[model samples]
Target chain A: MASLIFQIVVDSLLLGGVYTLMAVGLSLAFGVTRIINFAHGDIVMYGAYAAFFAFVSLNIDPLLSLLFVAILGAIGGYLLFKLTLDRILDAPGINQVLLTFGLGLVLQNVAVILWTGDERSTTPSYAFDSWFLSDDIVVAKGRLIAFGLAVAFVVLLLAWLRWSELGRATRAVSQNRAAASLMGINVRAMYALSFGLSSSFGTATGAIMSFLLPITPFMGFPILVKAFAIIILGGLDSIVGTVIGAFLLATAETTIAYVVPQGIGWAEGVAFFLLVIVLIVRPTGILGTVGRDA
Target chain B: MNLSRTSVMVALSVFAAVISPAPSRAEDTIKIGAPLSLSGKFVSYGAAAKRGVEMAVDIYGGKVGNKKIEILFRDTQSDPQVAVNSFTQLLSEEKVNFLIGPIATPMAMAGLPAWRRTRALWVVPGATTPLLEEEAGKEPMLFHTFPYGYYYHLALARSLREKLGPGKTVAIIYSDDAYGREHLPYAQKYFTQEGFKIVAEELVRAGATDLNPVLAKIRRVKPDLLLGLVQTTDGIQLTKQVYVQRLNIPYLVGTAYPQLKQWQDASGEAQEGWVGVTTYIPGLKAKADPKYPKLFMDSDVWKAEFTKRYNREPEFIDVGAYVSTCMLLIAIENAGAVDDKEKVAEELKKLDVHTMIGRGHFEPSLGGTLNQAFADVVVHQRVKGADAILYPKEFETADKFEQATYAK
Candidate 1:
């Protein structure tokens, strides 16, 4: 029983890494642009496909092709910002939401046309290989790798946000858009950069995940739903809160699944459950200030 | 370039000619309506079924008797309402008295009213809910090309008893939806009768991504066998988690795992020794006459053509669609009339034709439920990245089922 508990804990942490990677970019984009960027998950889908194609066609390993995926993702993100977001930055929220939602549908359909609705995966030699830490405890190598990369990327992003000039400008814009413009922070450029960086993060997460999970055109929606839950649990603008929220949600789900009878199916519902609790208990979120107005 | 009254009249005549309908040849055309889920969750199966039907048409020289055969395809998008709407349009607007598919059970059930109203001969290739047999009693036009889900579990239970002896404990993890709900009771009844102890039964929501929690619960019971009646993606997810969590069951059985390349890719090294009940096995030696492959019923010609066109191997669902379409065409030819729906329906009921899967016919004793096709359901096991028939000694590709080993 002790060993099973230990294993679940370890597994939950690794799973949390994946959720953190998925949600952080969503939080970032929402913080800076306040547009929600509904197509964020589709960008991740494209990244996974990019990594898969590189592995199959170029014989480049999935890990090696992450750089290529990030570059392509950035370019795609830039184009999206220029084409759609640029036109509707100051438009009604409904219009912004609909445009992003429509973009997601378009990307999903285009992916279906190119790759079909078949579920695909990249099986590196070590995908199923695992390490036995003890007699009953094991860790999957692919998931471990993904977990490590997720943490490393998160740290790098935090550092960039703390120290870089563009990062400070982005934070300023996110905090107060009109004031940032008065301070001559190139608010438009920050918006574009935030979108590009957010997409790159999302794509990198997908690339890492391709080695761990199955890929399909329709795989994006579920991940997107979970991301929404995470951002709401964390403050929508708080990076630290996003990471904490992911781990908390993962732990709750894993524990519930282990403790409750026939609970595995209900694990997915944990996200929405957390969203509801958070909304009722603290509408501003775990990290949001009481007086900060949007 | 000046326009005179004569030139204007001539130009007007050409415009009218371009826009007008050609002389009606509806009498010389046999229209077959196919309502398939072409753009949603079931698109993979729908697309493959479409390809199979097309190949069957091509093999028939695209005609039946003196009339050219025309297939009108409508997309259901995996929605039951859309399926009913499509079927209604096909019957009422398109005037197609012959129909195939709505390959999912819910869609098939929803479209039953349209089938009854139109009295169209509806031959289903993939939907396998046992409720279909019950509903067929009320709707004479409905026919099932595929066997019910109970038949699959029955074959699987028989194979398990033969291979593992008896008294082994079995746990069933099934999706809580139409396919799994209809089939689980049958699996329980058959497995229990076969002397296996029912250790655990679990229902998972459709499209659930994780199974670790359920696996954790099952680990406490430690059954000898795990039976998963889930979709293709869920099956792959379950196998992967089983390996990761080191569940260590002696055997794993499921549907849709025997023939999909995507299954192999998703499950990776964990796929070995996973058994599934399947109707068609690729690379099975064809019983075709070498001289006239196209004319022979058991020919690999259709398989080759399907591969060449789709750039991949076909699954049983594809062959099911192909065989069903071929049966319909032969019935049309045998009836000697393209538009006689009753005659064609009678010919179908009397069919004893051979197909790529095997001989095709319905049991007339079942009355309105005479639509269920009798086909072989063989147990296939994954061995070294390829599926090998392992049960019912006659079709054994390998001598016997091997124990699965996991990477440490």
Candidate 2:
């Protein structure tokens, strides 16, 4: 029983790392842009496909190709921002959501058209290779590498937000675009830059994930939902909240999914159940203040 | 000016050449629409099915009975709404007379009404839930390429009950939603009738990645044999979790598309000794000629061809898809026309086609008079270094499967 519990913890934490990365990217974009990019998952999916193509054609290792994936994501997000986000700056929230939703559909279809709609998985040399901590518990090298990268990216992002002028401008634009512009911040450039950065992180996550698990175009929907839940749970505007939300939700889901005695199907329902309880008990989330709009 | 005009003419001709292939279907060409899940959860089904369809069409020189046979493919994305929309677009817009699939059951079910309204023949290559046939009823235009879901579960139940005896407790873990609901009644009925005690039955959702919670519950029940009809992702996760948890039993069986290669690749030796009841083999080596069914074991062409083509041995699902397209082509040939829905429907009911699986024939038995007669269910296991077929002594390629040690 103890060993089983331990194994469950390891599995949940590893799975949680992917969720955290996805949620953090969504939270970052939502915080700064105040336009929830419903297509964030699609962006991640595009990165995954990009990485897959790179792996297949160029024979590049998926892990090492994260930089290339990030670049592609930046280009994609920049183009999407220029093409769609610029037009929707003053549109209704519902319209913004629809626009992104349409973009998601378009991206998914494009992938299907180009990639032939096949479920692709990177046969990373490290995918099957694992390091054993003990007899009962083991960490897959791909996932272990992904976890480290996720934590490192989150830290680096936090540092940038705290220390960088661009990050400060982004935060200002997120809090109040008019005020940021009045204060001489390049609000337009900031919005596009923030979106680009968010997409870059999202792509990196997908590339890392491709190494850890299978990458299919359909996986975007589930990841999108999880990220939405995490951002909401962590308080949409709070970076600290996003981080906390990612860890908390990942831990809660992983633990309950492992220990709840029903199976992982029960784990899916756990997110919604947790969402309800968190909303009722602490609407601002674990890290959000009373005034925070989660 | 002359050079520029000549260049313009060349570009126009090139563009025309590229664009004109769309309308060039030969008078004898058979056009079939396949709205399979090219993207989304069941993408592999579409991918593998497309591969088989392409292979079949290639072998047939992309024609049937001197007519060029063309498959109009659409991506359903595995959502019923998407499938319905695709079907609407395909039927109302593209005017395809014959339909091949929406691989999953629910999508197939939703698309059926549209096909029924149009009076078009639906010879689906995949999606075998009983609800499809149950609802189709007297609609003779519907034919299933895969065996009924109930037939598969029944095969598992009967084989296990007969081999292991009725006294052993049977436990099943299935999907919680409509897919699972469709099979519950039939599974319960068969288990009771077969005299095996239903020790425990659990439901798991489609999108779940962890099975530790359910596995915990299942372990608490501690039944002799375990059966699962789970989604591919859940199945892969569960199989790995079971190994990590070191839960061992006499038998563990799974239904649905469990990527055996992925599972084994992830879990290694732990994934050994697992058994599944499937309609096709991703890597089964069978002779080209059905006359010497036994010769599949010795056919280097079968092994070499499958390996060279697929980069892995063919799973039963691959064969299932291959056989499905075979049936579709046979119907096309028999009808002598693809655009005549009525004739295509008529031809389908009279089909007696030879496939990689076995000899299959459809009769006027169910929806659209397409009663399928292929009843043999083969049990496959990953034994040692290869996938060994264990059912029907004549087709037996390896000795009986033995258990591998749990990998924890």
Model 2 C-alpha lDDT per residue in residues A20-120, reported as the tens digit of each score: 88888888888888888999998888888778778878989888898989988888888889889889889888999999999998888777667654445
Give the Å shift of residue B96 in candidate 2. Answer: 6.2
- Model 2 scores a C-alpha lDDT of 0.71
Highest lDDT against the true fold, candidate: 1
Whole-model lDDT for model 1 versus the true structure? 0.80
| Cα error, candidate 1, residue B393 (Å) | 4.3
Residue-wise C-alpha lDDT for candidate 1, range B255-349, written one tens digit per residue: 75646878887687788888888777786655753433464445466677778888988788788888888889888988995688899989988
TM-score of each: 0.94, 0.79
CA RMSD of each candidate after superposition: 2.6, 5.7
The alpha-carbon RMSD over the true interface for every model, in angstroms, is 2.0, 4.5
